[model samples]
Target: MAATAVPVQSRGDLVLADPASPVATVPAAPQILVPATLSTTLDSRPLDLSPLAGPLAKIAQIEAWLGTELIEREEATRVALTALLSGQHAAFIGPPGTAKSLLILLLAQAFDLSKFITLCSPHSKLEDLMGPLRLSQLPHDIYERLTNAYMPASQLVFLDEVFNLSGSLAQTTHRLMNEREFDNGNRVERAPLISVFGASNQIPQTPDSAAFLDRFSFRLWLGYVSRTNFPRLMALYANRPSSAVLRVLAHNMPIFASQHGLLTLAPPPVTLGQDELFSLMWAAAHIPIPQSILSTLDKLYDDLAGKGIYVSDRRWRQSQDALRVNALLDGRGIVTNDDIAVYTNMFWTTREQRVTIAQVVERLGNPLAVAAVDKRDQAKTAYDAAIAAQADTDLDSGRKMNATVEALGKLKETAQSLEALLAQAQQQAMNPTKIQRALDAVQGWRKELSEYVL
Candidate 1:
């Protein structure tokens, strides 16, 4: 056989001549690199479910001290305690003399030393909260001393005038409030069993930041005592002992801790059921709400929606938790309308909002009672006039007019009756029977309004 001619390999420009030559494969396109950045987006953030430990006895002691001084504030304090025990923070806002600070100290004194720590000031620093660094005293470098001084205990910290802190200091609190940890150089230093009791003369117009606001699970407005409770408060103030009952109660803090500890670890979550909805709807139907009042409710709902404020889905489920506690305090197993009424007040952003919503519910429940009786009289007059004018033309007109006048007379009577029902329904000493009767009467008038256009 003739010697096979050796095939010469081509250089850089060589092309494959064989049908079965291996094809050149291009490397997969490199993934677009994402720059490392801090997450500011709230949606991606995890739920900060850090464990919370608070002395319930302390909360009860504080509540007892509040006594009858500030009924609204007292109720608000109960709600706040419920929120705190459930592992949440509360922000109490009020005028200077509303006893906001007093409540904080009272509550703090109730906690076991291991469970609560109080820090008050306009100049509280992160180091003060986490613990101080001992640079010069340390055998190692200054930074090493700082690393050794971290306190990791679960204690309640009371930050009075919390809004006055510098932005950096506040930012550190924002982290501590949410994550229960602070950035110490390269590592995160967890706080020892930490819970914050922050009080302010007024809630900041704009919170230090959204993160800071989110850290406070409940926001309460503590107003002055009701006029009815003023006398009792005065008596308590005038006869103030060397140590008030609150102090005595607080001194027995361990009793509260034991009682609180006995409370079921996880109480059932709060829920809005048919009874709540009916009670609210009945109240709404009876009250004659002004357009302005309706607008306020709408605005409040919108604001809460926009800011993602109010209770979170998980916490919203716990909104009714206070009801149970309130009931337990009152020695009841099932929550009643009164319990709900008191608890709902705690969730409102302002006194105006709470009063307005209550008014709307009242008006909706009994429109006749809420609407001006004089206006209905005027409407009756107009109807009578229209009937009289038609009477001269036809026999049917005279009969119809007479019938219309009779109907107006009956409506006036019904309206007066409904007004009485409404008065009883709104009474502070209202009973279930009266409320139920008022609800029935109001429902009747609503149906009547639908039928009688004039």
Candidate 2:
């Protein structure tokens, strides 16, 4: 497949003047800055993060808790944490039963963030998402959306099958995410939203839909447990088939709490509280884009452009905040080229483009890991295609089954090659973790393919 072109805007400049560096100022958040005083009296003083400390210190515990017994979501867990802690919108894409919903709920539950959750469809209306207008205002010829506890008023939002939204609803959502304000007819109300989360099984290809997705600064791709991780996933859930996080997210807290024969268990690790979250946001906002980091990003932008991947200027600027927070998550005060890997999630608009970004990031982040990452990605794509082929009733079962076997054979060879490369990288004492993930993926996929064969 030919590479798809993403829009490139001239405003994609990355240099930050020394005097105007973000470190010296508290970046403004409209919600806390000059938010509307809803009928709920939401408008008030701006956020002051000066006194807050160690938000990054407590995030690992949060990540570990959310990741408990979840399969193949190590990187997704970090992306979720970064999106939430950095207060940026993100989209999670994966197949059903892949734990996407479970993961988001755990993140939301950990922070106790006020959230509005809904499923989108072709018939979904704006009123369904933002809520009905104030009846009294309608009488006064003012159509004011009563946003109490709705997407516009909540600190976080999770929309399932978000791409199914009707054109009108999608447009309204685009405005709400990009502007952080709702057009109330009589007034433009500042939203209290910290982040808007979206999930889908596939990427949207239409221009408008692409624009809607661009509103999200980061996108995470989740896959099923590989042959390698399947055992771990099963071992963790051997006695119990369903996810504990699923039960909790379903409002079955008591049932979830009592799942084990032992009636009591220690409390799971947690996010410090909403106040602590505010402080983390404050601290993260103050993290500066050092000239060197910006310069690195500039070169990265060009490299991606060379490969026909174009990220909008706005996306890059917004992503910087999240990257800074990623640094913070590592208990670091400075940003590094290592952090550029986060851009891997930000640049791709389609599944095919994802591998390109991965190869690019891995190449720059760790050259030794590139071949492994590329090989593993190619094998996994073939394996995924084979799995998908079996589901297509139009295809000849005999032919498809044989093709799947061939794909599996190739995947096994690739897995062994990845293992060899991983060992070489490890012996060289280069970053082995990257290659390790690749090796795990192909090995797992190879196992998955074998199961399909049987």
Candidate 3:
């Protein structure tokens, strides 16, 4: 049957006869509390931005641009961007010459952000890192730090040798990273921080050090470019853009930029404002995560704990947004097994657990899980839409609401088929939880809609 569009009416309700079904009215629906921005996050529509690389394009563009020069640092760039999308700090731990500092420079240049970049040392002073106090304020009995372009005042920050911070610098940036604020005189000033990307050779194994590291949601292990890629790396370094060339293209290429050079304009910063970044972060927060994958995560965590590998309670909670952000970056609407493959970057706490956790996640991988999850989401969206239509006062008559009633009838048919799919999944010894839940929801919707069936 051909489906007709639901006509908009001015006075009388224009009834839509769904060729698909004869249902003309809907039953009472429960008042669904839609989440605010947060609820929109939970009830977030299936955001499909595979074409546009999602809302975090600026960050994605930075990652891609960095990848052009950074050899064997793909994971580092990816994890770093994921951390930003998750609105959590990240750490890069590797030996010198592993491009930790270089990656920082490239990343900072790839986008135009108010950044505070510092090379940390044992002698690093808080006054130097966050900025020195105003000399004028000292005589007036005010000790305000002039925090312009400093750690507390920046959006994207990079602290190389992060573990070498002096006591005051460490303590202050800790608050800045975690609390998003800085102590200025007797009061604290809110920071416009997105995430702090830190680089370190090693993490000191003290409880205090561990606590500080915990502030970062991800820590990617950087390694030397493999012997196989050594030739390419060497060639890359040989052909690397010199500071002189960069300056010429940036500062001296106004006239010749178009006539004889590929560098047309000075590097146009691929930038996003704080407002847009916050909105993208919120959109990233809404990316769909499936229950089956989450269930697998539950099993993975339990498995890791059994092996004496405990991820922190806080990390456990934050991993959701991280996973969702990973999905958004991969140009997908929902988290998948491919996105979860990056779990190694998130929860690997120790050298041994790194390999062990990878094995565990591999063992728990379910390729069919995403398909089931997606189907369930589709059913849920259909069910929710039907309910919302039933409750809409503007849908005043049978004609006005028939399209939604028809959707309910279609959902009923879908539920009948899903019941069989659930049965087969159960027979296969797979966790049919998602499919079963989806069927139950559609069944519930059908039951309500059937109350008014005539």
Candidate numbers, best lDDT first, in rank order? 2, 3, 1
Worst 10 residues of 3 by lDDT: 25-34
Best by lDDT: 2
Worst 10 residues of 2 by lDDT: 7-16
Q: Model 2 Cα RMSD, Å? A: 12.0
Alpha-carbon error at 20 in model 2, in Å? 21
**CA lDDT, every model vs. true structure:** 0.46, 0.71, 0.68
TM-score of each: 0.47, 0.69, 0.66
Full-model lDDT, candidate 3: 0.68
Pairs with backbone N, CA or C atoms under 3 Å apart (clashes), candidate 2: 227-444
Q: After best superposition, candidate 1 residue 206: deviation in angstroms? A: 3.5
In each prediction, how many residue pairs overlap at the backbone (N, C-alpha, C within less than 3 A)? 29, 1, 2
Model 2 lDDT per residue over 63-168, tens place: 7776674677878888887887777888998888888777777677667578899989999887889988789787788878788888888888999888888766
